[model samples]
Target chain A: MEGNIYKKLLEELELGNKAVMITVMDDKECGEKNCNRKILYTEDNIANSCISDLNKVVYEKAKQSLETGNLEFVQVNETESYLIEPYFPEPRLIVFGGGHIAKPLVEFGARAGFLVTVIDDRPSFANTARFPGAEKVICESFDKCFDLINLNRSTFVVIVTRGHRHDMECLREVLKHDTAYVGMIGSKRRVKGAMEQLVNEGYSKKKLDKVNAPIGIEIGAVTPDEIAFSIIAQVIKYRRLADGKEEKKILSKVNWPEIDRDVLMELCEEDSLPKAIITIISTKGSVPRKAGAKMLVWSNGKVSGSIGGGCSEGEVIVKSRYLLRDREYEVHRVDMTAEVAEEEGMVCGGIMDVFLEPFWN
Target chain B: MEGNIYKKLLEELELGNKAVMITVMDDKECGEKNCNRKILYTEDNIANSCISDLNKVVYEKAKQSLETGNLEFVQVNETESYLIEPYFPEPRLIVFGGGHIAKPLVEFGARAGFLVTVIDDRPSFANTARFPGAEKVICESFDKCFDLINLNRSTFVVIVTRGHRHDMECLREVLKHDTAYVGMIGSKRRVKGAMEQLVNEGYSKKKLDKVNAPIGIEIGAVTPDEIAFSIIAQVIKYRRLADGKEEKKILSKVNWPEIDRDVLMELCEEDSLPKAIITIISTKGSVPRKAGAKMLVWSNGKVSGSIGGGCSEGEVIVKSRYLLRDREYEVHRVDMTAEVAEEEGMVCGGIMDVFLEPFWN
Candidate 1:
């Protein structure tokens, strides 16, 4: 009976089905000469056997299976034991380019228990030595590599090549596949150029929209490792989205009035209160916030949102007021490294480019 | 003057101080004839000034300086902006062992901007080639390495050695240092054995109390990488604790009534109503929750917490009742890879181990 139940569970799991099992045992049967035992398996429908207090046993077994993703057997007295096998599948990481960033990417990905694979046209770049953790390293062109690997919905694709052209070639091929995530590393201008080239090549704008160009949420990443983090973070975000998990938003859930046309016009007016607008254009490394995450500070102690909290925010606040007083529209770059942000207890080693502009009446 | 300010900020930070700078700029001095120009540096005990209205200018300058960690300033503003350079020290990750896990540890630490270093006797494991991003990797015995590296009041140490003896060796070395955190991975038996050995070696109870043995917050991590994550998480927790940040507790903070002696005795009675206890022992790969996170199920469709939500939880719920009916304690393992976790919408590729036991009356 246990063997049959295990076989059934394995079959359902392999077929991508869910199930729950319940066992009802008689306590008196344990000490009695001839006692009957009953076991029930509930796949899509409910299955039961002749047992005292059947409803209670069935309800519990069903609920237990549902709550813990486990299978078990329950006796009438709730004291016997049985086994249930759960179905789980392996994870895979599909990297598009095999470059310097990809080198660490493969290693980290493999160490993270991702079935890693590397693909590149250049055999020198894509090889076993370059990516030891990569299960398969294919020395095929970008166009052919897609066919070689099964790019399913479970696959995670990262495009880190020599330059924009190769990145675009890989992106085009990956976009055709049913991949869960697709990330390409490049500058905003470069990404824009790549998009235009793809559009010119007759790829649909809808298909292009699926790609995460300038890949990774903008953290103003400069180093290869930092860039890799941004890409990985984006991939994780995509996974959460695919799984329907809500990503934590920096902004509070408060009901802020939308910016009106009048407010915009007033802000643009020449004769308005001189306001220092400090906008974070980009961020890299261990920054408190990502590229688009912002903090607005007024000449007064009033503040909104944050680039990073603690000392970083306080320092930015002081600078904004100075910019306002001096009437200077200057750009400042802040590097948050161990040596710099340490006193503030910030370990995010990131560099942020902030543009401070004066808008006044 | 710049050197003096730098020296002052460093001194203040060394004493674990916090200060805010206010800059008040003098606009009239720059454009007016025979106008007095000045700059001011103010602290709690001292107020030094070179000119009037220097507060605004210097404050702005200091704020920008603080952002970039560039303490020096160029005279871009005619008003002479005051730059505030707040001294902030970065957090450090002091890894006690250099093994397979340490390779990823150094990579993650460097990318996360922690001043990472590996201490191991094996030269191959602690070489620069293995840990390129690590600020330092000391290939020395545990005792010698502890003396060489400065374990300050904010250092986070993680012990991941090949065996219990090495873990004990490192633990002994660290106990004397004024480190913020120390985490070691092993089974309860191994941890108890190590602690016994340490006690026998004359280590004080107070010092042993500081170590988080059988660590990683009780998460049932089986694989090396999973164990690495659990250890890293604990280190991160301690890092936050050092910064006075609250660590997020996994279980919901619930209010429970104090039980009287009579109530406790009554609860333990044999004829009392039976209860069901469900615990998640271990999880693998991309499961929603890590191991050791659990939930309890009652007969009335009521539930608390979760193992992994969705169809997986639904299955667990079903099996729970069966265990209650059978009056049996059973262990169930579920693998929810590729298949959706019921309607909870989690696509985690992993296996989960759950134990169902009858709650004694």
Candidate 2:
């Protein structure tokens, strides 16, 4: 029976299937007149022994088996013992660009243990000579290449094509799959435009939301290497999170209940007074408010702080609840000039970009 | 003078030199009349801040400067404080293999932000195609390539060559340089043969000792990916150790100096000892003693424990001092049947291995 079990486990492991093994030892066999010893093993050869005294013995055996890449079972009788192993498929990085940044990104991604594949419509850019470390280089349009590759949760798609339109084209295809990560490199304006286009094309809001537009953590990165650092950092963050490991830095700040409630209450109180509180969490281009700046709102809906504010606040307040609900905290550029910012009747002269996070109790 | 200093600092950073940034602030800058602030920023952009009442303001500015990758110096006499930016070069990984394992290792190394270079004798194996992720791939004999690469304290070298001979040849080259890590992959016999050859070659025992033969933590690795896992684990361990980070493993029994001494004394006192304690810290090949195993040496000097006693124990004991000095310990093997073992002792049959560590105090 032990031999049969061992053979079965070996088969599964060879086939790359995940499985666990259990062994039970009868009391008599355990040197305990009436007690039984039990052990469990995984296909990975991780073993757990129920008998504390037999732990060292079983652990050594398990380790030895693991070292030899073998799966086996030994009967201790009555007490159960077994091994468990989980098969993890290799991870792959599907890059949709072969530009300057893509060069280092691919090299780094490959070196980091991801089976990297670089794709470009231009044959010159997507050649083996150009991407020597890339596991595979495809000189085909993103649309056509998507069909040739198999993507899954372990697949990471980086859409860093030459332009926003190309980036969007790549993102549209990537979003259709269950990719572990989908990041597109673009300016804030370009990202917004691409997102709007995707949303208009009837892509599910949920899928659109999953895309990391203007990819990479906000590090004010300018150079290719610096940008690569930001992208890799974000990837590492996601990988850690997926593995249930603690991330070195908090990717997104938690929206404390009390803070959310307080901010909401303040906004509500000012509703009757015609004032607004403007909080800025981020900024881009020529924006007045820096990230994390806040302004108080007053009666008659006159705002003290800016979202970039002139005409941007009234609509902002309407959408603020959604941002609060979704926890989509980010910087917004609000036009304060009445002509540009005043869609309704109220116009603030100064432009302020506000990052309003809902304060809830 | 201040401008000159700032310019010099900027130049160093731009040239990718390593440096730390320090910032000092006065009371008013931190929003408190009497409060002061000081901050330190490392190359990785990890910041340590000291602030009083004006913590929020100072933190914001410090973070901004760090994000912008700017290093500077500023002074505010009365009302406000200034910020400083510093630049530091990233670390580099010097790999010695150009094999299948090197593929992922190089890829992962790049992704992890290491300046990676692959060195292999086979031009086909070391070319851009095989190691695209490698910033530079040197196609030269392993021994010759060492002359071209500069190995500093920060450089990490991983040896996963095609065979043991190549590994040994590469290791010898790296052993002469100041490196953060030197990991070699091989089986027990291969490792022993390589080491023996090195010892016979007149290489200083101390320098050769730094190599992590059978490199990687013993995690029961079998597959190439798993082997990669082990190698990476060792690399990470070395990196962390070099960075002064503490490993959290339970202290080894051998590491306990008092206990080791007690065991030695007890063995010495035994008029008719039944068992001798022989500790084998390392081993290679078809030897009776395995690394980390403890054996009992009989009173007749007839050993029951093996330390691959052949010729490895003397070195093991000398090296064990590292753990012993720190009051940290581990077990090792001593084989008494080999020529060296026979020359040194009164043996019992196959091999006489003993644990020479001190017993529990």
Query: Which candidate's TM-score is highest?
Result: 1
DockQ of each model vs. true complex: 0.02, 0.01
Task: Grade the docking of candidate 1.
Answer: incorrect
Regions of model 1 farther than 4 Å from truth: A1-84, A162-223, A226-361, B1-58, B68-91, B94-107, B116-361
Q: What is the TM-score of chain A in candidate 2?
A: 0.49
lDDT of 1 at A355: 57
Chain A TM-score, each candidate:
0.46, 0.49
- Tens-place lDDT per residue, model 2, A200-309, is 99998777776777886554444475466556545544543342112233323211011122333344342333233345533444454443344554333434444444
Clash count (model 2, backbone only): 122
**Consecutive 10-residue window with the lowest summed lDDT within model 1 chain A:** A250-259
| Model 2 lDDT per residue over B164-243, tens place | 76777778777777666777888778888888888899888766667788786554443354455455545544543332
Error of 2 at A243 (Å): 7.3
